[model samples]
Target: MSTPALTLQGLGKSFGDVRALHDVDVTVESGTVHCVLGENGAGKSTLCNLVFGGYRPDAGRMLLGGNEFHPDSPAAAMAAGVAMVHQHFSLVTTMTVAENLLLTQHGLRMRRRDLTDRLDEIAQRYRLRVDLDQRVATMPVGARQKVEIVKALLREPSLILLDEPTGVLDPAEIDALIDTCRAVAADGTAVVLVTHKLGEVARVADAATVLRRGTVAGGGRMSKTSIAELLTAMVGRTAADLDPTVAATLGLDTAGPRAAARQRHSTALDATAPVLSVEGLCAERADGSTALAQARLAVRPGEIVGIAGVEGNGQSELVAILAGSASATGGTVTLDGTDITAARPATRTELGLGVVPEDRHRDGMVAGMTIAENLFLGQLGRFRRFGLLDRRAIGRAAQAELDRFDVRASGPWVRMGSLSGGNQQKVVLARELSATNLRCLVAAQPTRGLDIGAVDFVLTQLRRAATEGCGVLVVSSEVPELLALCDRVFVAYRGALTGPVETADLTAAQQISELMMGVAA
Candidate 1:
């Protein structure tokens, strides 16, 4: 009751036609961790942007420490003791850790030794031990996250807001981050965490606020609520009836129509055939340092294999190699028993290998292109009537997949960039899965940036593909999704695959946490 650290009353905002945030209210007490829970595009981002001065409130009032505060810009917000660590990192990669740490200091002139010393001091105080002299670009994702957290802490803000901070972190790194946040709260600083991870919400939040469709759905103190209860509220149903959550979080709960369609146990996949195989896969930088070393993997027909590890543990390299976008120095790749490692990405796609690339905006789809064009891009061969680009055929095909995949959008003619993040991901899924002759599917971070409902749709499609005898190899940092979806999970550490373990015998979350830190269990 010592006056809330921050308060919002009648909070509202909107884009031109979309009401991003409606008459919302939030309160953060001093020295407590407040968790804002929502699916992607549920107005969580809009709320934080308004608070951080990234956008002006269309209508609202903000009070910081019992005083009115409206920051015109991010710098002004920072100066007013409001700092936000965005979902995406904002550090300058070419700069050293110490340099990034000291970037915001005013007209600071100090020796390198003094800078390192200051960095070490901050690191020790906050329990974050980064390599002070190392460049930000070379650090792992976990370390880079620490750099951002430390940067915010160095300013000594009374309130810190983090937006989906753990989206890129593995299970182990997530635990460490939670510890750090708790330590910060113990120091009397209010922390606001925005995330969709219900487990994290239960673990760290003193109180939880649920948002749905730009409005507060429900909220309660964590001690008085459970993750299941919170999830039910955010989704607007009992946990038992949640089709999307069950399918996405636990791999098509054996009670839905899709699951009931499985009249009997399916036959095990053949262990002999290699729908997709890689041997001695090696990629090197121009400096002769290897990014991948002797990497080997195989995906058989009708199996979902997951690659699990901390971010930057060579997952990106593997994705690039398999996508046919990067050259292998000394490796052979075979698809459907034919060598195709040296082929261009388009050639690989022609050979029945579909890739749902890592970054949806950058690699998966052309943001500037219309949805119709992106959907029929590599499959032009299927629509070549009279040897001309068949607009009518493409439109029919794109519209079909869009409806099948439940992509909510203006139409097939709309630009991919205009869609929401969740819908954008659905677009990727639709294009990748629409190939009738696809022999193997390589999905990297397939459900990244997607909400629970969209995640369920994508996973269901993948499972149905597996049911229909298509091989699947999924790579994700999210353990629960992998645990629930993949038939087998493979541990990767420092560019090495630790082989696969059957999902029946292992929990995805625990195994992933162990693999991330190289622990034996």
Candidate 2:
């Protein structure tokens, strides 16, 4: 029998009492895209962390080409012909693409021409185009992702791991990326794709392994298994008929009264006045470059309005302006008849504006602070007594929010960084939603790294918030998310709004996909 390119035998990892992975066995052959499918907490990330040298396994043996492999660090893994493209780009944004590419062990002071030539050669070979001289900061999300992939491929690795690579990409970008991954696999490099997107698995992965509750549930060649079969394996149940997988998890019948309830809610949201409105909004960078110009939008009360666009096309700027973190160069922003164009972030908070920022690691919570401290970050005024923060009161409040939001963590005292990506997002949601007077809620990429269950919970929460008279504006790069949650959807292109169309009107995923790509209806 031929040895697999990569193999994991009885792999197990634990964080104190939390068993992230338990006795997981999987194998990947060369020249194939082997996908790992699991819900958010199913140890898929833990397994990847161990394999990519981000974490040491508690017990297990990893084999590469019939040889024992134990990578002590990411560098060590790279040396052993293993490369990982993180879900988030790891490039230094201030640096040029060529510099970022050469920053690894491949760093060498080559002539500028030589660097560009090398980049061009690699990109052409992999069919992953990128501007070598362009600053990483100026690149689009798709292009930045290409840079990460190019950097990994430049190392000539035997195994490449991509974690949620398409999570932040639009539908068209996703299709392009899928093609790129398929091409990469054709070049004899074993690709390990970690994702929750079943459609992607069906499209690009040659084989898929399903993990559930820290153990391998089932796996087979992608061609042999139907999408429904894979879904069953991943969730431990048959969910073929459900629009989304939350039907069983939420304890609701898909073809029953619950479906009717959701449909009624989705319908009721179609005919309401916007809780938040923006017209002729424009935002500029410090360098005087326009990030958003003439952007107009509306979020109806008791409904979610999703703004879908490729990243760096003014989504960040829009969020910053709305959240009052940055001043809008030109525009009117109103929340229920109150003009807040010049309001500070604190003032916006006081005016019932709840903002869950896109960059969770940077803007959502302070990494150094405890979960409790992070939860109470902008809400200090609410817990203050005679100009002093009530520490005991804040702790109690934090604990309550943690429980209510279903944030899985050790305690309120644990560092925010110690929790998983999903839990961190939950912390952000808890902070923003707890503000009782919130009328306009802005959630940007609310569930970027969360599992299927968490996605459902977050979406459900947003809908519940909307049902209570607070308008919700969701800006996401993922089309399925927008299609699943929002009542009215808008396509953002070069900082321009294109829609206020009802979800029922854009029922087909292809319609939303076309609009996001700047296609006219």
Candidate 3:
């Protein structure tokens, strides 16, 4: 064929003792989407980094359009017609979108009006709309992502790499992004999509490559390769090898039967009084700006309620209010008919409230502490005997929790930081759900940055918690997860709520999407 747009042969990279990628090979043809599929630590990031000239490969070589490509820096990569949109944004938050985009060009003076005009033209041409005057810090996550994409598109690169671009976008935005990618590819630019989201792969990929533990697992043309095969390659196991519940959740098994069963569960939940209720809730951010206003929702016992929104739209503040970490400026929070608006976090916990904070590393655990210590962080008094801590009892209890939760770690004695992201999440889930009197759970982005198996596990746990009669409030940007797990879904936009849409409704996705954009009530 014509020279491949990009090629990697026996690519290998390492970080001291960790082999991030090994003998990895991939090829991207002109005007096509090449997907790099893998789990959290599966070297997908390393491979992309190598292509972007962020890290020099430890072995093998890369070719760009029949030429040897060894870029020493990102600037060199850009000059060679390669662009990358990183998972975490690289924009200067204090700068305006136009200013940030202008910085990408070399030898360009700081001319705001000229840059804004150029940006507007590029945005119009690419069907990517971004306000040139908007500060990066003030824009929502989806808007920021558009800015990133537009930044890349403005470069007019022959090859563009997008890393987990959909993680922060709503469904409508995701569809728009996919369309944008297709349009870009249609223009003869090769695209590399690095994502763990299977739906995205199925929708956009022309060719797919699976990476498992730093090695190529399997890959083929997207149309010919079944999702089951891709899943097997990613996890190193067949569908039958997965936990049946997880398999069912991932839709590897028929969902028709599961839907009927869940419908019954939902019906039962509908008959009960709300276990947790928030009315006219208002909250302020750390900067004293209104983060939540007149937000109201209720979660019945044995039900899962979802708060869906784009990031920076008061979802975080609402979760904080429920978790008792932030004060509500105007509104009431009630748990099982008892007012908890004025209660401290510890008191809320005592009153049967469990919270899984969004930033697990910062709020969920003490990284330096042992798993046992982190597991029993707040309730260490139970392990006290004769005025001294009972280490043996604590260890034993911790091990049981770890085993029960299926947290894959060396042992309970291992430091919390030593476990993977998934395992750390399990510790949080186990601690929260296993509370003796847990009546309500506030889980914020519970599966963020987790692998497929880990996501399945977390969802299973949340469903199990609901089945055990715990009212769950899941605050997430992931629409699929919300749709799959929540009995009723509510959309949060600009500190307001619109929805309580039944999951069984055929128009749920569209309705939710409209609400998410603050378009429909």
**Who wins the lDDT comparison?**
3
Q: In model 1, which residue pairs have backbone atoms overlapping below 3 Å?
A: none
lDDT for predicted candidate 3 compared with the true structure? 0.84
- For candidate 3, what is the TM-score? 0.84
Ranking by TM-score: 2, 1, 3
Candidate 2 lDDT over 209-280, as tens digits, reads 999989998888976877677777777666644435244322233344234435744567556566788999
Q: Which candidate is the best by TM-score?
A: 2
Better of 1 and 2 by lDDT: 2
Model 3 bad stretches (over 4 Å): 72-76, 102-114, 236-273, 283-293, 309-314, 359-403, 408-421, 477-480, 493-499, 504-520
TM-score of each: 0.89, 0.90, 0.84
Number of residue pairs clashing in candidate 3, backbone atoms closer than 3 angstroms, sequence gap of 3 or more or interchain: 0
lDDT of 1 by residue, 237-273 (tens): 6656665324445332433422322221134565758
Question: lDDT, candidate 1, residue 82?
Answer: 86
lDDT of 1 at 186: 87
CA error at residue 496 for candidate 2, angstroms: 1.7
lDDT value, residue 309 of candidate 1:
77
